[model samples]
Target: MGEPVRSLPHLVGRRLSRVVVLIAVILSGLLLGAGIEAQEADNSTANLPTDAESAVAARVQERLGTAEFTPAIVVFDRGGDALTDEDRDVVQRKLSELQELAAPGQQVFPVLAEDGQAAFVGVPISAETPEEELAEPVAALRDAAAEGLPEGLRAQVTGGPAFIVDLSQVFDGADVRLLAVTASVVALLLLLTYRSPWLWLVPLSVVGVADQVAVQVVAAATQVFGFSTDGASVGITSVLVFGAGTNYALLLIARYREELRLVEDRYDAMRRAVDRAAPAILASSGTVVLALLCLGLADNPTSRNIGFGGALGIATAVGYALLVLPAAMTCFGRGLFWPFVPRVGDADPTRSGLWARVGHAVTARPVVVAVAGTLVILVCAGPALGVKVGLSETEQFRAEPEAVTGQLVLAEHFPAGSSQPTTVIVATEDRDRVESGVARVQGVQRVESAGEGEGSAVLSVVLDAEPASADAFAVIEEIRAVAAQQSPGALVGGPDAEALDASDAAARDQLLIIPLILVVVTLVLLVLLRSVVAAAILVLTVVATYGASLGASWVAFRTFFDFPALDLSVPLLGFLFLVALGVDYNIFLITRAKEEAEEHETKEAIATALAVTGGVITSAGVLLAAVFTVLGVLPLITLTQIGVIVGFGVLLDTLLVRSVLVPALVTLLGRRFWWPGRLSHDGRHDGRHDGRQGSPAGHVAD
Candidate 1:
């Protein structure tokens, strides 16, 4: 019997060697195919939901017999001095040169600042301009300004077009940086976790392939699904694949190492390890995938892309971790562990480690521990209710870029919204009435007939408030109300209007998608745990953690970061990640508890499970948190906010919720924690079970 058992691994390893080589070939082909088909990611707001602003923009374009145009503002400053005749002449010549470069039927206009220290040239470029095509026109305007500008005068290009060009440049090579940082973080963490230099390379290599494969898969899926890809989606996909894939690898490898000490053959140990780890990994991935898929119901285009793309990436990570990783590790045999290889009959270190002490303490006073944990999370959750959503365009950047600086200068000298006027498109017949109504709006500083179309006219209404400000949003809303009364089909569209619409869409998405995600996640947990009570506890705990994280982040954003308000998409995306990822730790803990309960009493099972899984789960959580924290390296405020919130939330879930709170709650609940399941009403109902079932017997401190 012993000889056959020992030989089983060799036989299986020999059979799998061919399969591993085939998988390697397939992965290489996938990588090559992906590289050949790679295309530039689109981050345009043209895919925003067909809200009022979008509909209005379309109508204006149709009426004018031209496509929508993005406004570019060139601000010329004379260093707080009144412009001289020479400066004015130079500016006028540059303005003319800029106008000459405009598309047919498009016009450029110049306005002097109230203080006479600055002036702006507004040039409208066709909105249909491809991203790569934008740099040329913008550069021409800049070059024209530089050609003959007076010594004291300085010109900067800003506004919608300039912002787009600059933002695209910021993200140009961001993928490489994000990948480098994420890979380094994961590799270092894995090295520390495994305590072996060589073991970390195997999982890291497999995960690298997984990350590449995920990108191609998600890109293809988005194209087929008719959803657009953005820089955020592409960037986050790498982070998710590496962070989550490595996590799954850690859990599997830890189990494989444990099985190695029990089983004589390396192949048999890995097979048993895969069997033990796959379920938890699958359950955790399922929760995240299902939750992210709920983003499809969102009204925001970016959210939708993230939802579908992130889900696909996670699914890909699971596949590689479970299938490719296991095969690769088995192919390497026992040598993969190197200096720390586990031998048969060796004791599990987890039997009495830091986790054992944690389990013992929590089991001693379950109620006290549970109550204290709940209170701590609740305290952190206090600020979330008052979180304000929506950041001004300038606030979107962690460090102010040239465009933002130009906007600030323009805002200080001119009507704040002059750089990007609120556009009201109305039928030519009602143009006069609609124009009068818009001009009469409370915040309208000035109104002009910027252009005319076949049967409609474009009314550019400059507001007293900054273009992306909340006051400007309110003013646009009022203008829309007035337009509806005077010109029934009039469309209100511009920078401020677009921002307003995005905020509304984000709010709607939060309301719609949040509930859907929670319901989906709850149902998934229920099915995976096979216990309604356990699933409910897990969901509630994660939700609590999410609230705590958001609330804490709100304080951090306002107090430390000095951000005026949260980005429109932050709350929705943050919730999606926190809930989905936070629940993962719970899944890791409870699944092990269920398995342990098959042999021991409920309380003893909880303690033993905690001692066994505490280290791996904590390491996984810390590793995921660290990878996400790398997002802060980017200069985008949205990414920074996401990194801080998700990183902090993961730590909270891992240390407080999973390590202490969950074990205490399960201990307090006893057999009832698994209500309606066979384990809940078995012979071990009274915490008196002692014998092992179906596996090797081991001691678990009570």
Candidate 2:
């Protein structure tokens, strides 16, 4: 019997070793497969949902032939002076040079502003030109404009093709910068949390691998599901994978450190930690995934793509955190904890630490804490009601790009919509009526017949208002109303009309998707917590946090950033991120509390759970906020606003709502908090299981 028992230890070690190797092989295979598939992935507008604007675009494409073309406007200004004959001759020569350089199927036309202080040459890109090939023609035009300009004259390119070129340049390597910043932030946080030189690299490396895999997976989704993807969606995927994966890593590692003090063998310690942490991680991830998946029901293709990509990222984060991280850490053994390694039989430091004191204070005056928290959140949320949605093209960028500069110069000397004319497609026979109706619209500066087909004709209506401004959208509505009376089948489309349609689609999506997301997330929390009351409380807390964040962000945007208006997509996207990620922290806290309640009375359990999970949750929250803040560095207003709103919201959830308000409510409703659950029926008297015997005095916890 002694001989067999002595061999048992070797047998267990061998089995554990085999398990680790198997996990590594599986992860490696997955990485290899993802890498290969990613090379063939497509990210383009070809997959955009057939919304109203898309239908208009399709009709326009059919009329114009298969080649997609965008106009490049080259604006030339001679300060505020009228053009002399010499200036006109110089500009005409430059325009002729530009026209000569135009590609096949392209056309260049020169128009002098009525004031004659500025003139622009409009160069149409060839329909045969691919998206990647647009820069060549735009570059040629710029180079042509650069040479031989007269004194006091300046020239720059703007308009659709030029804007695309500039935008592409701005986003070039943005993913790399975001990844670098996120990795650095997460690495520093992990190092501080563990105070170990080597421990941070393990989870960081795993998350990096997981991030790459997630990108490929999202790319795969775009190809397989016919969903559209843009630079914004791709950037968001990286942030989610890194931020969420690191968050799960922090929670699991923190719990593993605690379990190490209770279990002698590293393998057993890991098993116990994973078994205990998996539920909270899964519940949190599931809530986020379900909430994001609701975006698929959105009318906007961008929202659908973000929903699918974000959901996939959360799922991947959870998988690697629960599977790969644990396997890798277990293989590394006790040395992973380094200098402050936990020893078996050591007492948990959290039991007498800051959160324990905080828990006491919160429980002592639950009503005061709850009311104060509620009021603070409500005050912050009040500003959200005043939020205005819709950003003009000029407002989309934080700093003025060349395109915006050119547009401004053009606006100074010409009709605001001269560069981008609203196109009306009507029956050939009704063209005269449609053109007359469009000419009579309030903002219409001029109307011209642009092209004609077998049974249809295209009319270009130039407006006096900025093409992408609110006034322009209103004018489009009038034009549409007029067209309906004159030409029943007329299709109105242009840069301004497209913007209006997009804004309307976003508004519809918000109304349709918000309630759907709320329902889905609430159902998920109810199932995960197994208590309707607890789930409802969590939902309410997250909603309040979202509103507060949006309100605060709106103030920041107006006062600090000098933004004129919010991006059309910001509100819905911000809501999705805040509510989903906010619930993540709640799930972490409440799940731990539920676990503790099994062994202690409700009050003591709340105290113990808060004490044990406080540091890790706070660290995770800070890391996530920092990661999101990196989005601001990209120079896009939509991304910057989202970063601010979501980052601020996560901090709010961590420090106030999850820490104080939630615990206070749980304390005040002791046993009743978990109504209809076994814990409610099995609960011991409050404050009795632990050493405390009566109501404690209120005091702030760290």
Candidate 3:
């Protein structure tokens, strides 16, 4: 009687404190959103590493006052026939109008191709200028080219400046689209999972706000760190927050709902839910955050920034879900659940669970389940053998942009690399020899001096193949070797050389980052599970899931979508996401199994874990997979490939690997699964279990 009397005030105080914390979290979020302005991430910083030869040449050119030049090529053609007299007049007229739109020193004129079928002018724009400043003049040129065109003769803008504008144009409004699609998908899934209008709103509202806050946080981080970022990386990060954050919410809410049935007081129920959910949430989020931070080691500026952005975004999501979400949920009390409010002594939701049946089937035949899963993974891996890498500049877009069309047209009428030639920089004394040597290289159409600086000169070398092509990349290498032999300090730098260097950098990043990611994930799993056997199995299954996703996505890309080659960034980015995120579902599953194992036999605990967790984990998995699919809307091949690969990988983890393989392994291994852990030694441990408690059998229904 004295104890009850004493605890009453403490209970009331605890509830009041929760309300205060809830209000603070909400107020803090609003302040964060309103206080910080979103600065667009800077992606124009060179994509290449500073130490790359192309980057070196760029520095020399900057010193020579020529680094700012980004030529916009204006192509005029009359289709199959040579340029007519009227077409030539229209070209000359347009060039005259374009001259007024150019920067102060830019010269605007057209030189006819040797075939007399087309003509182009390389109008200079400063690459160093802000995108907004560059866009104004470029828009004027495009607008001017569109009007006053002779009926048959059409003008199209292609080249470095035009393509850069095209890239920016497609990415316009991408974030809003991704947010809408992701929100819609999550909302629909929540409705289906909860079967209540009001309950869906809680997690959705919480996750929605978290996503916006994360974006702002990432934007702030980008400004603070000065890391390179693009629309694609930012969009991808937002998707991750919504997907992973909602997943965390689902896991917590499911546990909370399960607890609500066992307790009458909403606060006590929530306390139990948080106590159980927080460890698994922390472990999984920590693994993802740590793995993402490893991307800071990547050479590509975009990958590195994603590392920072993803980490910040996940941290924001986890903070809000674990802290703010619980408070908001309890504040609503049982009323928020509507018709399905969980009552004290209510029927266990999992009594008729579908996942329990799956467990039964698996436990009855673990060997068959294991063998079949392995065979499926192996079969899916076949298409990966034919996977290609490298997409040329024009091929970067999903739906061809105007610039790609114009570039293709330019290739038809002029030297393939005429519009965007490679620039070789060398000392003035070495320029002649470098040019002679470069011109003599196979596939080199032309090489000539462009400009001279204090001690350096620039040579524009046109290739027979389109820039960013295998043929053109080879030519770049040959030119570099020849130029270096002729002049020791000669350097090759241009769009083609930059692409070559970017590809090589991605390869090196893969070699170093992949191994580190594996080790990091392994260590996290080992520490969390306290079992080498469990950690190794989880890591191996995740690796298999990654390989299977790649193989499957590559086949689909080739057979259905007709993608020529996977982008160089695709493999590492896919691996980074697939392996790290692939383990997320497993962490949720095995952690629950371990908790159940403390009170039951190993096989029964796994089955019970599967039954209780199956619904929420599946919902989380599907939601995550769908949110990543939102990347397809961006129309960048790289982003789409990422979406497809990660999307498939997550489904594999959720549906096949985590759902089927990991469980069977655990059931078969039994006590050995927890080997060396204290649980393994005793086969039991102390936990809170009361006569009034609900059983794992309660979860089979959900």
Cα RMSD (angstroms) for every candidate in the order listed: 3.6, 5.3, 4.3
lDDT of each: 0.81, 0.80, 0.82
lDDT of 1 by residue, 164-246 (tens): 78777777788888898999999999999988869999899989888888888876775576776777777777778888899
lDDT of 3 by residue, 139-206 (tens): 77788888978788888887777777788887788888888998999999999989998899989988
Between candidates 2 and 3, the one scoring higher on TM-score is: 3
**Tens-digit lDDT track of model 2 for 1-702:** 000001012211336655854766577577657654332212223123465853565467566653255578998886678877887788788867887866665678899988878888888776456566777878888888978877777889998777777777767898788888888988998899889999999999889888887887777776787765667787888899999999999998997898789878887777666766777787788888988899889877778878888899889888878877877787777888888889999989888888888988998889999999999999999999999988877777888888889998888888988887788887889999888878988999999987777677888888999867889989999999898788887788777887788788888999999998889888877777678888788898899999999999899999999988888778898999888888888888887777666556777778788998888999999999988888888998888998999999999999999999999999988888887665666424234454433222110000
TM-score for candidate 2: 0.92
Question: Which lDDT value does model 2 have at 374?
Answer: 94
Error of 3 at 122 (Å): 2.1
Query: Cα RMSD for candidate 1?
Result: 3.6
**TM-score, every prediction:** 0.93, 0.92, 0.93
